[model samples]
Target: MKNNLTSQQMGKIKNLFADRVRFNKVERLVYSHDMGMMPEQVRALIQCTPDAIVQPISTQEVINIIKIAQEEKIPIVPRGAGSAGFGGSVPAKAGIVIDFVRMNKIIDIDKEDMTATVESGVVWQNLEGELSKRGLTLRTYPSSSDSTVGGWVAQGGNGYGGYEYGDFRQNIVSVDVVLPTGELKSFSGSEIDKVYSLCGITGLM
Candidate 1:
Protein backbone atom coordinates (compact mmCIF):
# COMPACT_ATOMS: atom_id res chain seq x y z
CA MET A 1 0.00 0.00 0.00
CA LYS A 2 1.09 3.58 -0.59
CA ASN A 3 1.66 5.97 2.29
CA ASN A 4 -0.03 9.35 2.55
CA LEU A 5 2.17 12.34 3.20
CA THR A 6 2.07 13.85 6.65
CA SER A 7 2.76 17.55 7.19
CA GLN A 8 6.44 16.92 7.73
CA GLN A 9 6.58 14.66 4.70
CA MET A 10 5.03 17.38 2.58
CA GLY A 11 7.51 19.94 3.89
CA LYS A 12 10.35 17.65 2.94
CA ILE A 13 8.87 17.27 -0.50
CA LYS A 14 8.79 21.04 -0.88
CA ASN A 15 12.38 21.48 0.24
CA LEU A 16 13.58 18.67 -1.97
CA PHE A 17 12.15 20.24 -5.09
CA ALA A 18 13.08 23.84 -4.26
CA ASP A 19 16.46 23.45 -5.94
CA ARG A 20 14.77 22.40 -9.18
CA VAL A 21 13.09 25.79 -9.63
CA ARG A 22 15.27 28.28 -11.54
CA PHE A 23 14.18 31.68 -10.27
CA ASN A 24 16.85 33.87 -8.69
CA LYS A 25 16.19 36.26 -5.84
CA VAL A 26 14.74 39.03 -8.04
CA GLU A 27 12.64 36.68 -10.11
CA ARG A 28 11.35 35.07 -6.96
CA LEU A 29 10.58 38.45 -5.46
CA VAL A 30 8.63 39.57 -8.53
CA TYR A 31 6.61 36.38 -8.51
CA SER A 32 6.19 36.74 -4.74
CA HIS A 33 3.86 39.65 -5.42
CA ASP A 34 1.09 40.35 -7.90
CA MET A 35 -0.94 43.35 -9.13
CA GLY A 36 -3.77 42.82 -6.67
CA MET A 37 -4.08 44.46 -3.24
CA MET A 38 -7.37 43.07 -1.99
CA PRO A 39 -7.20 41.52 1.47
CA GLU A 40 -7.99 37.91 0.67
CA GLN A 41 -6.07 37.85 -2.57
CA VAL A 42 -3.06 39.72 -1.23
CA ARG A 43 -2.87 37.95 2.12
CA ALA A 44 -3.78 34.50 0.94
CA LEU A 45 -1.09 34.30 -1.72
CA ILE A 46 2.29 35.87 -1.12
CA GLN A 47 4.18 33.25 -3.01
CA CYS A 48 4.19 30.74 -0.14
CA THR A 49 6.80 29.03 -2.22
CA PRO A 50 6.37 26.13 -4.66
CA ASP A 51 7.61 22.59 -4.33
CA ALA A 52 9.07 22.58 -7.82
CA ILE A 53 8.66 25.08 -10.62
CA VAL A 54 9.09 23.44 -14.00
CA GLN A 55 8.78 24.89 -17.49
CA PRO A 56 7.07 22.59 -19.90
CA ILE A 57 7.52 23.33 -23.61
CA SER A 58 4.79 21.23 -25.09
CA THR A 59 1.28 19.95 -24.39
CA GLN A 60 2.65 16.48 -23.76
CA GLU A 61 5.01 17.80 -21.12
CA VAL A 62 2.15 19.65 -19.44
CA ILE A 63 0.12 16.45 -19.40
CA ASN A 64 3.01 14.53 -17.88
CA ILE A 65 3.55 17.13 -15.18
CA ILE A 66 -0.12 17.14 -14.22
CA LYS A 67 -0.17 13.35 -14.13
CA ILE A 68 2.74 13.30 -11.69
CA ALA A 69 1.11 15.92 -9.53
CA GLN A 70 -2.21 14.05 -9.48
CA GLU A 71 -0.52 10.72 -8.76
CA GLU A 72 1.10 12.27 -5.71
CA LYS A 73 -2.06 14.18 -4.80
CA ILE A 74 -0.07 17.38 -4.69
CA PRO A 75 -1.70 20.69 -5.44
CA ILE A 76 -0.63 22.01 -8.85
CA VAL A 77 -0.75 25.62 -9.99
CA PRO A 78 -0.39 26.38 -13.66
CA ARG A 79 1.08 29.78 -14.45
CA GLY A 80 2.10 31.63 -17.57
CA ALA A 81 3.46 35.18 -17.12
CA GLY A 82 2.01 35.07 -13.58
CA SER A 83 0.31 38.41 -14.05
CA ALA A 84 -3.20 38.81 -12.77
CA GLY A 85 -4.87 41.73 -11.01
CA PHE A 86 -7.02 39.19 -9.12
CA GLY A 87 -4.10 37.06 -7.93
CA GLY A 88 -5.43 34.08 -9.81
CA SER A 89 -1.88 33.04 -10.67
CA VAL A 90 -0.90 32.60 -7.05
CA PRO A 91 -0.52 29.09 -5.81
CA ALA A 92 -3.06 28.29 -3.14
CA LYS A 93 -1.57 24.97 -1.95
CA ALA A 94 1.98 25.59 -3.22
CA GLY A 95 3.00 22.36 -4.85
CA ILE A 96 4.11 22.31 -8.49
CA VAL A 97 4.26 25.57 -10.42
CA ILE A 98 4.15 24.74 -14.08
CA ASP A 99 5.34 27.80 -15.98
CA PHE A 100 4.46 27.65 -19.63
CA VAL A 101 6.53 30.72 -20.54
CA ARG A 102 9.01 28.65 -22.51
CA MET A 103 6.25 27.13 -24.57
CA ASN A 104 5.96 30.35 -26.63
CA LYS A 105 5.51 29.42 -30.22
CA ILE A 106 3.17 30.39 -33.06
CA ILE A 107 2.63 27.02 -34.67
CA ASP A 108 0.69 27.97 -37.76
CA ILE A 109 -0.89 30.91 -39.56
CA ASP A 110 -3.31 29.93 -42.24
CA LYS A 111 -3.73 33.09 -44.24
CA GLU A 112 -6.43 31.64 -46.44
CA ASP A 113 -8.46 30.45 -43.49
CA MET A 114 -7.75 33.53 -41.36
CA THR A 115 -6.71 31.36 -38.45
CA ALA A 116 -3.64 31.26 -36.30
CA THR A 117 -2.51 28.42 -34.06
CA VAL A 118 -0.21 29.30 -31.22
CA GLU A 119 1.30 27.67 -28.19
CA SER A 120 0.07 28.66 -24.78
CA GLY A 121 3.16 30.70 -23.93
CA VAL A 122 3.30 32.80 -27.07
CA VAL A 123 3.21 36.53 -26.41
CA TRP A 124 0.50 38.66 -28.01
CA GLN A 125 2.98 41.27 -29.16
CA ASN A 126 4.99 38.67 -30.96
CA LEU A 127 1.91 37.64 -32.83
CA GLU A 128 0.99 41.23 -33.52
CA GLY A 129 4.44 42.00 -34.89
CA GLU A 130 4.43 39.01 -37.18
CA LEU A 131 0.88 39.37 -38.31
CA SER A 132 1.22 43.07 -38.96
CA LYS A 133 3.74 42.33 -41.68
CA ARG A 134 0.93 40.64 -43.54
CA GLY A 135 -1.47 43.49 -42.74
CA LEU A 136 -3.40 41.25 -40.37
CA THR A 137 -4.07 41.44 -36.69
CA LEU A 138 -5.85 39.48 -33.98
CA ARG A 139 -8.19 42.59 -33.89
CA THR A 140 -7.59 42.80 -30.14
CA TYR A 141 -4.60 42.89 -27.82
CA PRO A 142 -3.95 43.29 -24.13
CA SER A 143 -2.38 46.61 -23.15
CA SER A 144 0.63 45.34 -21.26
CA SER A 145 3.67 44.65 -23.38
CA ASP A 146 4.70 41.85 -21.06
CA SER A 147 1.25 40.30 -21.22
CA THR A 148 1.28 36.84 -22.75
CA VAL A 149 -1.12 35.35 -25.27
CA GLY A 150 -1.75 32.34 -23.10
CA GLY A 151 -2.41 34.43 -20.02
CA TRP A 152 -4.60 36.80 -21.99
CA VAL A 153 -6.66 33.98 -23.41
CA ALA A 154 -6.86 32.22 -20.07
CA GLN A 155 -8.33 35.29 -18.40
CA GLY A 156 -10.28 36.44 -21.46
CA GLY A 157 -8.52 39.79 -21.38
CA ASN A 158 -9.48 42.89 -23.37
CA GLY A 159 -8.03 46.25 -24.34
CA TYR A 160 -9.17 49.87 -24.59
CA GLY A 161 -9.34 49.58 -28.38
CA GLY A 162 -12.04 46.97 -27.89
CA TYR A 163 -14.68 49.62 -28.34
CA GLU A 164 -13.97 49.66 -32.05
CA TYR A 165 -12.17 46.33 -32.59
CA GLY A 166 -14.44 44.28 -30.38
CA ASP A 167 -13.89 42.65 -26.99
CA PHE A 168 -11.48 39.79 -26.38
CA ARG A 169 -14.36 37.34 -26.04
CA GLN A 170 -15.56 37.92 -29.58
CA ASN A 171 -12.07 37.87 -31.07
CA ILE A 172 -11.27 34.38 -29.91
CA VAL A 173 -12.03 31.84 -32.60
CA SER A 174 -11.24 28.84 -30.45
CA VAL A 175 -9.64 27.69 -27.22
CA ASP A 176 -7.81 24.64 -25.87
CA VAL A 177 -7.83 23.79 -22.21
CA VAL A 178 -6.77 21.17 -19.69
CA LEU A 179 -9.37 20.76 -17.01
CA PRO A 180 -8.74 19.64 -13.42
CA THR A 181 -9.94 16.19 -14.44
CA GLY A 182 -6.51 15.48 -16.02
CA GLU A 183 -7.73 15.65 -19.56
CA LEU A 184 -6.51 17.76 -22.48
CA LYS A 185 -9.50 19.09 -24.41
CA SER A 186 -10.12 21.49 -27.25
CA PHE A 187 -13.41 23.38 -27.50
CA SER A 188 -12.81 24.97 -30.90
CA GLY A 189 -13.17 23.60 -34.44
CA SER A 190 -16.37 21.76 -35.33
CA GLU A 191 -17.21 21.39 -31.65
CA ILE A 192 -17.69 25.14 -31.46
CA ASP A 193 -20.49 25.06 -34.07
CA LYS A 194 -22.62 22.93 -31.76
CA VAL A 195 -25.27 24.71 -29.70
CA TYR A 196 -25.09 22.16 -26.87
CA SER A 197 -21.31 22.09 -26.38
CA LEU A 198 -20.19 24.47 -23.68
CA CYS A 199 -16.83 23.05 -22.67
CA GLY A 200 -15.45 26.31 -23.85
CA ILE A 201 -17.01 29.05 -21.76
CA THR A 202 -20.09 30.62 -23.33
CA GLY A 203 -21.90 33.96 -22.87
CA LEU A 204 -19.70 36.88 -21.81
CA MET A 205 -16.08 35.80 -21.66
Candidate 2:
Protein backbone atom coordinates (compact mmCIF):
# COMPACT_ATOMS: atom_id res chain seq x y z
CA MET A 1 0.00 0.00 0.00
CA LYS A 2 1.14 3.55 -0.70
CA ASN A 3 1.89 5.96 2.14
CA ASN A 4 -0.49 8.85 1.63
CA LEU A 5 0.91 11.06 4.40
CA THR A 6 4.17 12.92 3.85
CA SER A 7 6.99 12.62 6.37
CA GLN A 8 6.43 16.17 7.58
CA GLN A 9 2.75 15.50 8.18
CA MET A 10 3.62 12.29 9.97
CA GLY A 11 6.09 14.19 12.13
CA LYS A 12 3.48 16.74 13.11
CA ILE A 13 1.04 14.00 14.07
CA LYS A 14 3.74 12.21 16.03
CA ASN A 15 4.43 15.39 17.95
CA LEU A 16 0.78 15.57 18.93
CA PHE A 17 0.12 11.88 19.72
CA ALA A 18 3.63 10.56 20.29
CA ASP A 19 3.65 6.71 20.27
CA ARG A 20 -0.11 6.63 19.76
CA VAL A 21 0.31 7.29 16.04
CA ARG A 22 0.32 4.18 13.89
CA PHE A 23 1.81 4.36 10.37
CA ASN A 24 2.55 0.70 9.82
CA LYS A 25 0.91 -0.82 6.77
CA VAL A 26 -0.48 -3.78 8.69
CA GLU A 27 -1.89 -1.62 11.45
CA ARG A 28 -3.44 0.75 9.00
CA LEU A 29 -5.01 -2.20 7.23
CA VAL A 30 -6.45 -3.43 10.53
CA TYR A 31 -7.93 -0.04 11.31
CA SER A 32 -9.25 0.32 7.76
CA HIS A 33 -12.30 -1.84 8.40
CA ASP A 34 -14.67 -2.51 11.22
CA MET A 35 -16.78 -5.57 12.16
CA GLY A 36 -18.27 -5.31 8.69
CA MET A 37 -17.25 -7.93 6.18
CA MET A 38 -17.37 -6.36 2.77
CA PRO A 39 -17.13 -8.27 -0.46
CA GLU A 40 -13.87 -8.05 -2.35
CA GLN A 41 -15.48 -6.04 -5.13
CA VAL A 42 -16.81 -3.48 -2.71
CA ARG A 43 -13.59 -3.31 -0.75
CA ALA A 44 -11.59 -2.83 -3.97
CA LEU A 45 -13.87 -0.03 -5.08
CA ILE A 46 -13.72 1.74 -1.74
CA GLN A 47 -9.95 1.42 -1.05
CA CYS A 48 -10.53 0.63 2.61
CA THR A 49 -6.87 0.88 3.60
CA PRO A 50 -6.25 3.88 5.85
CA ASP A 51 -3.10 5.99 5.46
CA ALA A 52 -2.57 6.26 9.21
CA ILE A 53 -4.22 5.54 12.56
CA VAL A 54 -4.07 7.94 15.54
CA GLN A 55 -5.26 7.52 19.10
CA PRO A 56 -6.19 10.76 20.85
CA ILE A 57 -6.79 10.49 24.59
CA SER A 58 -8.38 13.88 25.12
CA THR A 59 -10.71 16.40 23.52
CA GLN A 60 -7.84 18.89 23.06
CA GLU A 61 -5.78 16.27 21.25
CA VAL A 62 -8.73 15.60 18.98
CA ILE A 63 -8.88 19.32 18.22
CA ASN A 64 -5.22 19.37 17.31
CA ILE A 65 -5.70 16.43 14.95
CA ILE A 66 -8.61 18.13 13.24
CA LYS A 67 -6.44 21.20 12.71
CA ILE A 68 -3.73 19.17 11.05
CA ALA A 69 -6.26 17.34 8.89
CA GLN A 70 -7.78 20.65 7.85
CA GLU A 71 -4.37 22.11 7.00
CA GLU A 72 -3.32 19.02 5.05
CA LYS A 73 -6.70 18.47 3.40
CA ILE A 74 -6.86 14.83 4.45
CA PRO A 75 -9.99 12.90 5.25
CA ILE A 76 -10.44 12.27 8.99
CA VAL A 77 -12.26 9.11 10.05
CA PRO A 78 -13.29 8.86 13.72
CA ARG A 79 -13.58 5.36 15.15
CA GLY A 80 -14.48 3.65 18.41
CA ALA A 81 -14.66 -0.09 19.09
CA GLY A 82 -15.45 -0.75 15.41
CA SER A 83 -18.34 -3.00 16.46
CA ALA A 84 -20.83 -1.91 13.83
CA GLY A 85 -20.87 -4.04 10.71
CA PHE A 86 -22.01 -1.23 8.41
CA GLY A 87 -18.80 0.31 7.17
CA GLY A 88 -19.34 3.33 9.39
CA SER A 89 -15.79 3.13 10.69
CA VAL A 90 -14.12 2.10 7.42
CA PRO A 91 -11.97 4.59 5.49
CA ALA A 92 -13.24 5.18 1.99
CA LYS A 93 -10.33 7.21 0.59
CA ALA A 94 -7.43 6.10 2.76
CA GLY A 95 -6.72 8.93 5.19
CA ILE A 96 -6.27 9.31 8.92
CA VAL A 97 -8.24 7.01 11.23
CA ILE A 98 -8.76 8.56 14.67
CA ASP A 99 -9.16 5.69 17.13
CA PHE A 100 -10.84 6.74 20.38
CA VAL A 101 -10.05 3.63 22.45
CA ARG A 102 -7.60 5.48 24.67
CA MET A 103 -10.19 8.10 25.55
CA ASN A 104 -12.43 5.59 27.30
CA LYS A 105 -13.21 6.88 30.76
CA ILE A 106 -16.28 7.08 32.94
CA ILE A 107 -16.02 10.67 34.04
CA ASP A 108 -18.99 10.88 36.35
CA ILE A 109 -22.25 9.25 37.31
CA ASP A 110 -25.05 11.42 38.58
CA LYS A 111 -27.47 9.06 40.29
CA GLU A 112 -29.82 11.90 41.21
CA ASP A 113 -30.14 13.06 37.63
CA MET A 114 -29.81 9.54 36.19
CA THR A 115 -27.06 10.80 33.93
CA ALA A 116 -23.50 9.81 33.25
CA THR A 117 -20.71 11.96 31.94
CA VAL A 118 -18.35 9.73 30.02
CA GLU A 119 -15.87 9.88 27.22
CA SER A 120 -17.18 8.74 23.85
CA GLY A 121 -14.77 5.83 23.67
CA VAL A 122 -16.41 4.12 26.63
CA VAL A 123 -17.88 0.67 25.90
CA TRP A 124 -21.52 0.00 26.68
CA GLN A 125 -20.84 -3.19 28.62
CA ASN A 126 -18.34 -1.45 30.84
CA LEU A 127 -20.76 1.37 31.50
CA GLU A 128 -23.50 -1.09 32.27
CA GLY A 129 -21.31 -2.88 34.80
CA GLU A 130 -20.56 0.36 36.56
CA LEU A 131 -24.19 1.36 36.53
CA SER A 132 -25.24 -2.03 37.87
CA LYS A 133 -23.04 -1.51 40.86
CA ARG A 134 -25.13 1.54 41.67
CA GLY A 135 -28.44 -0.29 41.06
CA LEU A 136 -28.85 1.50 37.71
CA THR A 137 -28.63 0.50 34.09
CA LEU A 138 -28.67 1.93 30.61
CA ARG A 139 -32.07 2.55 29.11
CA THR A 140 -30.85 1.31 25.75
CA TYR A 141 -27.73 -0.16 24.25
CA PRO A 142 -26.62 -1.94 21.10
CA SER A 143 -26.77 -5.71 20.93
CA SER A 144 -23.00 -5.74 20.77
CA SER A 145 -22.08 -4.67 24.27
CA ASP A 146 -18.53 -3.90 23.12
CA SER A 147 -19.74 -1.03 20.96
CA THR A 148 -18.63 2.40 22.05
CA VAL A 149 -21.01 5.16 23.11
CA GLY A 150 -19.76 7.44 20.35
CA GLY A 151 -20.34 4.76 17.72
CA TRP A 152 -23.90 4.21 18.91
CA VAL A 153 -24.64 7.94 18.93
CA ALA A 154 -23.08 8.44 15.51
CA GLN A 155 -25.24 5.63 14.10
CA GLY A 156 -28.56 7.22 15.13
CA GLY A 157 -28.84 5.96 18.73
CA ASN A 158 -31.10 2.99 18.06
CA GLY A 159 -30.58 -0.16 20.10
CA TYR A 160 -32.10 -2.68 22.49
CA GLY A 161 -34.62 -1.25 24.99
CA GLY A 162 -35.17 1.72 22.67
CA TYR A 163 -38.81 0.72 22.25
CA GLU A 164 -39.38 0.81 25.97
CA TYR A 165 -37.31 3.86 26.91
CA GLY A 166 -36.01 5.77 23.88
CA ASP A 167 -33.20 6.05 21.41
CA PHE A 168 -29.74 7.24 22.37
CA ARG A 169 -30.50 10.78 21.22
CA GLN A 170 -33.22 11.17 23.82
CA ASN A 171 -30.87 9.98 26.55
CA ILE A 172 -28.06 12.36 25.68
CA VAL A 173 -27.83 15.53 27.76
CA SER A 174 -25.05 17.03 25.67
CA VAL A 175 -22.07 16.24 23.52
CA ASP A 176 -18.68 17.92 23.09
CA VAL A 177 -17.38 17.82 19.55
CA VAL A 178 -14.43 19.15 17.61
CA LEU A 179 -15.69 20.53 14.34
CA PRO A 180 -13.92 20.17 11.03
CA THR A 181 -12.57 23.68 11.36
CA GLY A 182 -10.91 22.72 14.65
CA GLU A 183 -13.51 24.48 16.77
CA LEU A 184 -14.66 22.74 19.95
CA LYS A 185 -18.34 23.11 20.64
CA SER A 186 -21.02 21.54 22.81
CA PHE A 187 -24.41 20.51 21.50
CA SER A 188 -27.53 19.79 23.50
CA GLY A 189 -31.29 19.39 23.10
CA SER A 190 -32.39 20.05 19.52
CA GLU A 191 -28.87 21.11 18.53
CA ILE A 192 -27.68 17.53 19.08
CA ASP A 193 -29.37 16.52 15.83
CA LYS A 194 -26.74 18.46 13.91
CA VAL A 195 -24.08 15.87 14.66
CA TYR A 196 -26.08 12.77 15.57
CA SER A 197 -25.87 9.95 13.05
CA LEU A 198 -23.78 12.23 10.83
CA CYS A 199 -20.97 9.63 10.74
CA GLY A 200 -18.42 12.19 11.91
CA ILE A 201 -18.76 14.39 8.80
CA THR A 202 -19.51 17.55 10.79
CA GLY A 203 -17.14 16.86 13.66
CA LEU A 204 -15.34 14.42 15.91
CA MET A 205 -17.13 13.61 19.16
Best by TM-score: 2
Tens-digit per-residue lDDT, 123-165, candidate 2: 9999999999999999889888998998877887678999998
lDDT of 1 by residue, 74-168 (tens): 76666667666665565555555667778888889879988788887788789888888888877677777576766766666568579887756
Shift in Å, residue 171, candidate 1: 1.5
Off by over 4 Å in 1: 1-30, 37-47, 189-205
Q: After superposition, how far is residue 108 of candidate 1 from its true place, in Å?
A: 1.0
> Which 10-residue window in model 2 sums to the lowest lDDT?
150-159
lDDT of 2: 0.89
Worst 10 residues of 1 by lDDT: 196-205
